[model samples]
Target: MPSVHIRYDNLKPAVKQVLFGRLRLESTRWASFKSWYQFSAFYCAPGEAGAHEKGGVEHEGGRFRRKHLVPPPQVDSLAELNERLAAIDVAEDARHIHGRPTSIGFDFEAERDRLRPLPDDDYDCGIDLTPTVARNSRITVRQGYYSVPAKFIGQKVRVKLRANELWVFDGRQVVARHPRLTRRYTYHDFLDHYLEILLVKPGAFAGASALAQARAEGGFTKVHEAFWAAAKQKAGDREGTRMLIEVLLLHRQLPAEALVKAMETCLRIGSVSTDLVAIEARKAMEGTDDDDAELLTGDGPADDAGGESAGQEAAGARVISLHARRLPPDPRTTLPDMSKYDRLLNLGTARETSQNQKGQGA
Candidate 1:
């Protein structure tokens, strides 16, 4: 882009400051514009001096609305609407204008070849902010609340605000990203981010914004609901909700598809517990059924197996065996003679009687 022609009123304060070589304006895209593109800016005269300056831009806007916005689109999300508009733009590129020999797309292709390639690094088009996460692990940006991991509560984080997205950074690391909400006071919560806190406060999980969003978005599937209900029936509500939170936390370590499949298996078997859910999830992730047999039989690899050997054990290595061994009694045994034992007993008795008679005489 060689230059940009803009009306005085349309120029942002920062841009105006840069154009006029003034130091009053705060830092913003004006600095980026000078550093990144180095394009010449032409400002039209104020008011009636340049009434027709933006006539072409106005005409193009009207044409776009007439061509594509005559029938408004109904989309579930801003992303969907943007996708539709992008498709429309691409389609319109093929249109031929009056008196033009080539289509718009052809002309654009010819002109695009002359354009400069984008820089290696992307420009920061988002506003920077530092907001502290609240006790609920939620931060407010542009009046829209978004959840972060619970561990970040009470900690300040940097937030980058784009037109349709919010990127949160802890120092240089991006901790979370959310679709920017256009509605005031609306919240966007991610259930996975709050699972740790939910485990400690299971009652709140039932009414939390994160859980509500998960339910609305179909992330909380029927399997999840069934598992929760079964767990609640087996245990009380609090314990059951905690169990559900544990199952949900598995999503952090396991692929969500695998975890959901495990939950479905649990629901089918009428066995719902955190331990069972974790075991099922591990089985699903490992893509093996050997653990099922081990679990059923309450037997695992023998303790004598070395760690490395145990790890190398075949997936199908599950076998049971029973054996018994006896030792023979000692062979050097003989029966005693009853006659010699009786003679010794009679002699001892007679000696004791003689001793008693002598004592009486004395």
Candidate 2:
């Protein structure tokens, strides 16, 4: 085709005017990608001559989408959707295309050896954006809000947004990343991104959106809760939460599973020292197998600028339960009597009252 319509701001425009927009120039993005993929493009002459070639490609793709993606497959994530598509492609390979005597698989097998391997490095298909960080430490991208570091507030941070993830850059470093928000006007945030500001405003943390989201997403687990409550009791709420925030910063240095196990150990010993938590987390890391221990980096800093952040693995991973890693508490152990447990039956808050009145009243 002679022209392409460029979507303004890489977003759906308010005016329904795709038929007329900025005139199609050569695509810088596609040109860059062609070099990486080592592919050539052959465009036909304008008007009727090129129309057949152009329409056929899109028509075939539409047919595939309508056949395989109609009614929308129920999937938890994009990765699952990709898996479904792969399976569908495999299933389709058994069938022959129109006028083809051999199956698609058979045709592919004949030419498979000629296909070159993909480039060693992944080609980033994301759009580079520079959104200003709001006072709430968030940047609005595609009608959704996402928190950055508080330090970036009132300043522009480099951002790269892909189909499933968004990565924020500070100069040459990846400071934060989050799953791309699907719902319009919704935000996905990390607690660590706000921990610096929360240190000065500890009281705000209890009601923070990040903290609530963390709990909902299981980044702040029951272990972290217990530690926070203990710290709050030992110190005041303000100080305790501050202490917890300090411990939270340790995620930058320790793997999430290891840190959680350490927190559990410290809680068991009735200690809330941040130092103890760090020491215990390190000990847990020492015992953990290197291959199994992947650092939960979405909560902290990502790699240097050289690496492109992919949203595929972009979500904050839930805390792995450590209950089975250690022995279960002995069930037959005696416990101090709790009168409230007996009060369910209106049994006068006493076990003796409950014991004698077993079947006397329902």
Candidate number with greatest TM-score: 1
For candidate 1, give the lDDT of residue 68.
83
Q: Candidate 2's residue-wise lDDT over 9-107, tens digit each?
A: 212222222232332344677668667777654443344644564645667778898998898898755666778889998999898878989998999
- Give me the displacement of residue 137 in model 1, in angstroms: 2.6
Worst 10 residues of 2 by lDDT: 1-10
lDDT of 1 by residue, 197-265 (tens): 778889898888787788898999888888899989988999988888888887878888888878877
Error of 2 at 310 (Å): 57
Superposed Cα deviation of residue 102, candidate 1 (Å)? 1.9
Backbone N/Cα/C clashes per model: 0, 0
Model 1 regions lying over 4 Å from their true place? 1-9, 17-27, 51-55, 70-72, 289-362
Q: What do the candidate models score in CA lDDT, each in turn? A: 0.76, 0.76
Structure candidate 2, residue pairs in collision: none
Candidate 2, superposed: residue stretches over 4 Å from native? 1-25, 44-60, 74-80, 96-101, 288-362
